[model samples]
Target: MRQDAGNRVPDRLTSLLLGGALLLLPALALAVSPEPKTFRDWMAGCDNRKSCAALSLPPLVADTTAYLRLERPAGPDSAASLILRLSGDWKTPPATVELKLDGTPFPAAGKAMPVTANDNIATLTFQPADTAALIDAARKATKLSIAAPGLLAEISLSGAVAALLWIDEQQSRLNTPSALIRKGSAGAAPAAPALPVITARPASGTLSEKGGKALAAALRKHIKQRDPDLCGDDASPAVADEAWPLDGKRSLVALTCSLGVYNASNAFWIVEGNAVTTAKPVNFPQNDGGATNMLTNGEFEPKTGRISYFAKGRGIGDCGVAGGYAWTGSSFVLTELSMMGECRGIGSDDWITLFRSEVKTAR
Candidate 1:
């Protein structure tokens, strides 16, 4: 009887092991399948020196797209590198992993590699032969996959052919970088124009009419392409649409095309010392309603020098938020974002102070 009990233990363990192996069969089959319809756009480009690269996202379970870049050597002598820039909470455990490509067995595509990490970025280096194989598989295969123990990344090869061709042209400089690659001259691509320097406003005194006009002109010149898209063509016509005063004798200038209630866009510039720079809301709400949910109207408190704005809640009539900010020498820090949701009922409202430095001093 004791011998039978010992044999039963071994049989139970074998059954459990078999069940686990059966569960992994489907996942292994999926890893080799050719159908991959989840990947979005594939983008490839090169820098001025003809160093080319390609970036794309694998099939993601979430709505966001995290890019993984494969870069080739700039010239004939440079080394190859693969970069993965991660965001939010997506990451694999820090360990050495073997990457199998195109359904190949482990070490068939490449050896076991340790991924180096820097903050939110992970990098891996490769030889030229492996790099060429990667590009080739990207161009020809229907589905390119890289599998590790806990991570399985799959990218659709729909536009990879065009992307690889673009990379080739970028490296050879056959034609100026454009939408497509074609045979052309062999000279260097022309240098791109430099971005203008934005000056800061004076700290001691308010901007005079001439200073304000100069600063506004610089702002318009720098944001010409962006301004038209955001606020339309008539934004900041002749002069700035609105201007307000802030601490340190500075001014806040606003540019807008639509003054009506809905679908209106506005850009802001802050004048300090003798320069004007773009400024964003210190605390912008991240909600399903988008940018319109942020605090729109802003005003400076007379006695406290604190900046305040109107913050709307998430839904149509969920609540109203009163947001406040204080310039702390370095940045406009959020002081408070208080909400009052009970419109016609007797429910209690909620008030939360994000930063209390200015509030503590005021008290």
Candidate 2:
């Protein structure tokens, strides 16, 4: 499972003793939309354009994956529903499963469905209210465990809060549906600070000498500290003629290192605050039978608030691709991609003229 990298949100919300009360609560109606926006931990999408959101948990020593999804159909929908999808791995599936949050039984307004197997899927459906309860439990608890006749597994509640916040942001519900999301809700979820606004500068036709010197210095420092074997000197004549401001305080510097005419590598870095930190370097294809990195010609678009780069295809007939990444508070996300005819050369104009396909996230 992929790990989330950021300051951990504390679980401070209090939970009600609703094990019995929830059984009598009614469901809440909700909506789903087609191709809705998504974050790292949450997804908002329609199986076709209604209001739906989903949270997936990394399994803990389980053979199958698990998902918690909420769906509210369009207008006049009586109630929203929460559904659980589990991987089927049992020989004799259980008829019911109980959920626990932080060692306490979680309230459920509806009964769990019998474990149905379709190929390898196990499904459980609950009334919309139950889904709301589960989401709330997740926010305030450290762990969530599912218990069944022959299965027992738990999920760490590390990313649950962010996932739910993403959902609320999409619907503009402001936590109206679940008390857990409200300011005074039992969870008492702390308001997350706004992400630093990263603005881009108007593209300058050329890179400044100061920027080039900074880039070369940063790369040499990185090589000396991280990979002395690949680079013998930090004073090599590396140049960064291409520079783009990522924001008022940060910049992106593109650089290339050539081993020879047949061996070369290209990479870029993010200069954060006033310091340049070690960055992940990308390797480009060389004529000397080496694996190639597709990313090149990195630039930041001020109007779109996105960083883009040219990417060449690996396969002989594959098209050239343009990739764009959006800045999340903590990291970058690949949110835009475009494909064109074969990339005969990284800078060939013919490739751009032969646009084939594109997909972009709705900003």
TM-score of each: 0.39, 0.36
Give the clashing residue pairs of candidate 1, or none: 200-275, 201-272, 201-273, 201-274, 201-275, 202-272, 202-273, 202-274
Deviation (Å) of 8 in candidate 2: 22
For candidate 1, write residues 26-106 as lDDT tens digits: 111111111111123454544323445555533324222234456553443344465443222336443554555456743
Clashes of 1: 8
Determine which window of 10 residues in candidate 1 has minimal summed lDDT: 22-31
- Candidate 2's displacement at residue 221, Å, is 51
In model 2, the Cα lDDT at residue 324 comes to 48
Give the worst 10-residue stretch by lDDT in candidate 2. Answer: 20-29
The predictions' CA RMSDs to the true structure, in order, are: 21.5, 18.2
Clashes of 2: 14
Q: Give lDDT tens digits, candidate 2, residues 104-163.
A: 776643334455556545668866566666766766677767778767766566666665
Q: Identify the leading candidate in terms of lDDT.
A: 2
